[model samples]
Target: MIDLHLIGIGTGNPDHLTRAAIAAMNAADLILLPRKGDAKSDLIDLRRTICADVLTGATRVVEFDLPERDTSAPYLGAVEQWHDAIAAVWRGKIAQHLPDGGRLALLVWGDPSLYDSTLRIADRLRADGLAMTVTVEPGVTSLQALTAAHAIPLNMVGAPVLITTGRRLRAGGWPAGVDTIAVMLDGDCAFQTLDAPGIEISWGAYLGMAHQALVAGALAEVAIEIIEARASLRERHGWIMDIYLLRRAVPVA
Candidate 1:
């Protein structure tokens, strides 16, 4: 049996690693780091840095290429095929490295329970009939890091906070009943779709990392600024992962 540990390493910052996550890394027999080409080489480099700082066990480190999703297919179908391909890669790597079966670990970005697919991929391994045990070590999430970096509370007192994706915000518009919404996986800046009447936005890119950038103000006031900044940064860096929080102005009683 292969004991698989999925550890969340937080958003690219070495300091964001938790004590539990550190200990888990030190205990693993093998750690798998995924390479997503040169555009995202920084991600793998961060994982290596974490391993260098915390790994104490005789754990061997392995690198594997991440499969790119075929965007020509429909979104859900493409994602499904992508997950299967990734599972196959994982199986091959594990079998090749641990012919006798042993413990393995993967460093995940942000909390695995959040918008990440590490757990879903792990589940795919189970469906493929791989006899392996899986465990998760939760770490700080991008949402938490964004909020902390801005020194703002996620929601108003006695209020609900909606966690959603950029696609949902773009397609369905602002959700009702909740003034606060945290959006992820939004490459399109879905906030631009809003009417921008009483909405305020707090946006962060590369939260908790060295090149972090944050901007906040009335949606109408700073929307263009964010767009320009995001474009410039993406061009300079070749890729970006960002999240933002939006709030509608609450009326006074």
Candidate 2:
């Protein structure tokens, strides 16, 4: 049986790793790092850095090319197929590296419980008849990093917070009842699609990383600035991962 450790490394910050996560890394026999092409090579590099710092065990670090998803197909279908392909790649790597089945580790960005799909892919491995035991080491999520960077609470004292994707924000506009919204996985500036009336936004890109950028102000005041800044940053760095929080100002009764 393979002991699979899904370790959360936390939004690119090595310092964000918990003691438990570090211990798990040091205990793994093999650790697999996925390279998502030249545009996102920094992600692989970050994994390497973390391993170098925390992994004291005689763990073999292997790097594999991550398969690109087919965007031409329908969205949900395409993602499902992509996940299958990733699982196949993973299976091959594990079988080749640990034919006898041993402990393995994968460094996940942010918390796996958040928007990441590492857990789902792990489930696929189990479904394929792989004898594996999965363990999750939770780390600081992007929401925590974003909120900390902005020095703002995620929700009002007694109000609920709605966490969603940029696509949902675009398709449904502002969700009712929930005054605070945290948007992730947004390739486009979905905030531009909403009416900026009484809305405030706190946006952060490459959170917890060295090249972090943050912008906060009334939506009407900083929406264009954030767009131009994000575009320029993406062009300069070749890739970008960003999250933003939006809150509607409570009307003075």
lDDT of 2 by residue, 1-253 (tens): 9999999989999999999999998889999999999998888888989988887769999999998999898888989999999999999999899999999999999999999999999999999899999999999999999999999999987889999999889999999988899999999899999999899999999999999999999999999999999999999988999999999988665
The true-versus-predicted C-alpha distance at residue 123 of model 1, in Å, is: 0.8
- Candidate 2, TM-score vs. the true structure? 0.98
Cand. 1 TM to true fold = 0.98
Segments in model 2 whose C-alpha atoms lie over 4 Å from true places? none
Backbone clashes in model 2, listed as residue pairs: none
**TM-scores of the models, in the order given:** 0.98, 0.98
- Model 1 Cα shift for residue 242 (angstroms): 0.6
User: What lDDT tens digits, residue by residue, belong to model 1 across residues 1-253?
Assistant: 8899999999999898889899888888899999999998887888999999888769899999999999899998999999999999999998899878888999999999998888899899888888889999998999999999999999999999999999999999989889999999999999989999899999999898889999999999999999999999999888898999999999888
Write down the lDDT that model 1 would get. Answer: 0.92
- lDDT minimum window of 10 residues, candidate 1: 39-48
